[model samples]
Each structure stands twice: as structure tokens, then as C-alpha cells.
Target: MKMRDISESQRQFALLGGIFAAALVVSLIMGWILFPSLAYARKAQPINYNPPLHVEQIGITCDTCHFFYEDGSWAGIPTLETCVDCHSDIIGASPEEEKFVNEYVKKNREVKWALYVKQPECVSFSHSSHVRMAKIACETCHGPQGHSDPKDYLANRITNYSYVVYDPRVPLNAFTIIRDKGETVWGTMRMDECTACHRSRGTSTACFICHK
Candidate 1:
């Protein structure tokens, strides 16, 4: 009778261990893999923009389109007027270029480019300070977008926030994974990265500084 009781207890222990292991595996797969995959929805740009081709081949610079206004406020994205200067006619055999000329340029309509790194309305960020005064390279925060494939961009379904790291090299697994205990792996803009960058540069982390 004692032997049977011992055998029963061991069986229960083994079953519980197996169940716990299975639950842990399921949790990790669901939280790390499944949730992230579902959290973002892929969307295409109006046109497939090749930055490196323009930059390297045509000698176009970042500020050529993304220029600063005389008032020092940054021109976040180029306007249709700016694009019209070059794209008045299709310069290349690219179907995207043709589409741009016919659909937007011909219509005199602005290309509604999706914006990444849109901060909350309460937060006031000065790109001039960071770009001009600090002399920080655009890649420092935005990643090497010049070399990135525009199609790799993804938007978070919940927040509608687009990711800046358009690199095909970086895996999307970084989208929503946490390592060890508290280390967050990320591909998109987050408050932690912002605060961390500021702290590293000895910039102000005070709420009022950003939350104007």
C-alpha cells in the first residue's frame, strides 16, 4: 500500500512538472512571438522611395528635401512643391515615379507620406537643437534609413505609430521581446530609448522640458 502511494505521488509530481513546462513554453511563444506578430500591421508607402539611389547616385543630400525653415523649425517631410522641382516629369523608368507624376504631381496634390517618430501632442521636440547644435547624426535615432528598404517599415496597430528602422537586416523579433529580466528589445521608438539617449548626452530628462 505504501509503495502504491509513493508511486501515485511521483506520478502526480511528474505530471505537474510536465504541465508547468508546457505552460511556460506556451506563454513564451504567445507573449514573445504571437503577440508581436499580431500587434503590427504591414502597410505600403504611396511610392517605394529609394534614398540611397538618390543620395549616392544623384548626389542628393538629406537636407535637400528635409530642409529647415528660416524660423529654425524643421520641415519634417518634403512638400509636393519640393518634389515637383525634380519630379515634374518622370526622370526614370520606375513605375513608382510614373505613378507619382500621374497620380500626385499631375493632380498638384501632396503625397501624404506617413510619418514616423510622431511624439505626443504635449511634447515639443526641436530638431534644430538636436541636429544643428548637438550635431547628432540623423542615423543616431532614426537608424540608417538611407540604406534601409522602405518596404520594411511597420506600423503598430494599437498606437498607429510607424517604425523608423526600415532596415531589412534587423529582424522584427526585436519588436516586442524582453531579455533576461528587464532588458527590452525594440525596433520602434519608445520613451525608454528617448530618455536613455538624453541621459547619455546629459540632456534634460525633466518632464517640463519635453512636455510643454
Candidate 2:
């Protein structure tokens, strides 16, 4: 009777251990699959602007829409007047174009575009220095925006900051290293990435160059 009771207890313990291990495996798999989507809120663009299509038709460059001002400050988002210059009249019969004309152009309101690149308040970036002095192509940092299709923009809901999503064209091998190091890597711009690029180009390494 004593031997039977001991065997029964051992069997129960083994069963419980197996169940716990299985639950842990399932939890890990679920976390791995769902974490990325949960971390980001993939919001669709308010205006369906096909960048690649516009680049082909308009013959306008990226700088045409996003250019540095006379004061050497970057105009991150273009104003409504910029669009009205070419889109005042119904340039295309598309629904998006009609919506733009009626809602924004006629009303003389700027399209509230969600800015993708946002640095912290302490960081100061000069587009004039990078573009004019460094002579960097817009595509180098921003990727081939002219050749890519318009897709949903990603942002962190908690921080209300923009983040960089995985791009097939640009491999994010650094992300793998970040994950391996057990660090919380967001889709946003990382200091390491910026430093790496600067090192490659032999740019200024001074802390004051980027930090305010």
C-alpha cells in the first residue's frame, strides 16, 4: 500500500511537470507571434497617396515636396498651398483626388499628415547640413520612397512616436542583435543606427552634433 501511494505521487508530479513545460512553450510561441503587432498600431494613411505612381507622372523629386527652408531648417511636411499648386484643379478623376480638392483645398486647410521621422525634444537635426553640405541623397536615409508603394504607417500608441517597420528591401540585421542582447528594440530610429551610419561616412562624432 505504501509503495503504491509513493508511485502514484511520483506519477502525478511528472504529469504536472509535463503540463507546465507545455504551457511555457505555448506561451513563448504566442508571445513571439503576437508581440510585434501588439507593440505597433499600423494606421492607414488618411490620404491614399501613391508615391511611386506620383514620382513617375509628376517628374517631381523628393526635394520638390520636402525641401530645406532659406533659414536652413527642414520643412518636414508640405503645406496645403504646396498641393493646391498642382492639385487645385482635378488633376485625376480618382476619388482620393476629389476628396483632397473638396475637403482640404477648397477649405484651405493643411492635411494633418502623421510625421514618420520624429526625434526627441533634446535632439537637433539640420537637413541643410546633411543635404547641402554632406550631399546625401534623400533615398539613402529615407529608403527608396519614390519607388515604393504607399502603405500603412506604424507608430507606438503608448509613446505616440513614429517607428520604422520592417522593410524587405532594407535588411534589419541590427534588430537581430538587439533582440539577442535582450534589449527592447522599437521600430523607431536608434542612436546606434545613426552612429553606425555616421562612422561609415566619417561624419562628426561629437555628442553635441546630434544632442541638444
Candidate 3:
């Protein structure tokens, strides 16, 4: 009778241990994999934009589209007015180019390109300071965006921010990394990245520098 009772107790213990282990596995899957997948919903851009194609075909640099105004403010994205200069007539044989000219340019409608990175309203970033004074190339911070395929772009559902810059927790394969001018560049424009860069350059990272 005593032997039977001991065996029964051991079996119960083993069963509970197995159950606990299974629960832990399920919890980890939900937390790490399932949750993130559900959180970030993929969104499509208003129009298919091929940056590399434009750069290759037209030989136009990034500044041609995103130039600085006379007041030293950065032109974040080109408006229809800017694009109309080239796109008033269909310049490319691609169907997308035709669609763009007819559907948007002819109708005088803006393409409404999705913003990949937008600084918070409280933060003030001087592009001229970084691009001109610091002499940082656009690829240094923005990665090889100029060389990237537009189809690779993804956005977050909750914040409407670019997944490339905002959600760094995703798999490494999701982010595009490229080597430019002997420097490896990838996206993840978080505070830590900025702080690390500042620390490397011995630059002042006072709260007032970023926040108004």
C-alpha cells in the first residue's frame, strides 16, 4: 500500500511539471512571436515609387526632390508641384508612370507619399546642421533608402510609423542593411541610436537640444 501511494504522488508531480512547461512555452510564443505579428499591420503606399529607378534613369540626386528651401528648412517630401516639373508628361514606358501622369498629375492631385520617419511634434531636428555642419551623408542615418526597393517598405498599425525605424524588435531579416562608403547602415531611428552617435562624437545631448 505504501509503495503504491509513493508511485501515485510521483506521477502527479511529473504531470504537473509537464503542464507547467507547456504553459511556459505557450506564453513565450504569445509574447514574442504572436503579439508582434498581430500588432504591426502592413500598409501600401499611395503610389509605387522606385527611388533607385528614378536615380538610375534620371540621374537626379536626393536633393533634386527633397531640397532645402531658401529659409533653410528641409523639403521633407516633394509635392505635386515639384514632380510636375518632370511628370507633366509621361517620361517612362512603365504603366505606373502612365497611371501617375493621368490619375494624379493631370488631375492636379498630390501623390500623398507615406512618411517613413516623422519626428515627434515636441522635437526639433535641424537637417541643415547635420547635413551641412556635421557633414553626415543621408545614407549614414537613413541607411540605403535611396537604393532600396519601394516594395520593401512597411508601416506600423498603431502609431502609423515606419516599422523599419520604429519597431526594432522584429526579426533581423525584416530590416534592410546595406554597406555604403565602408559603413554599414540599417534602420532603427530610436533615441538610443541618436544618443550612441552623439556619445561617439562627444556632442552635447541636452534635452533642450531635441525638445523645444
Off by over 4 Å in 2: 1-6, 161-187
User: Looking at candidate 3, what is the lDDT of residue 171?
Assistant: 37
Best by lDDT: 1
What Cα-based lDDT does every candidate model obtain?
0.74, 0.69, 0.70
Against the true structure, what is every candidate's RMSD? 4.2, 4.8, 4.7
Who is ahead in TM-score, 2 or 3? Answer: 3
Per-model TM values vs. the true structure: 0.80, 0.81, 0.82
The model with the greatest TM-score is 3
- Candidate 1 segments whose C-alpha is farther than 4 A from its true place: 1-24, 164-166, 174-188
lDDT of 1 by residue, 1-212 (tens): 35445677888999999999999999999998798888877666788878878877888778999999999999888999999989899997989889999999999998878766667677788889899999998877666666646664567788776654454554544353234112322244567877888999999899887778
TM-score of 2: 0.81
Q: What local lDDT does model 1 show for residue 52?
A: 79
For candidate 3, write residues 26-89 as lDDT tens digits: 9999987787666656665778777777776668898998999888899988999999997889
Ranking by lDDT: 1, 3, 2
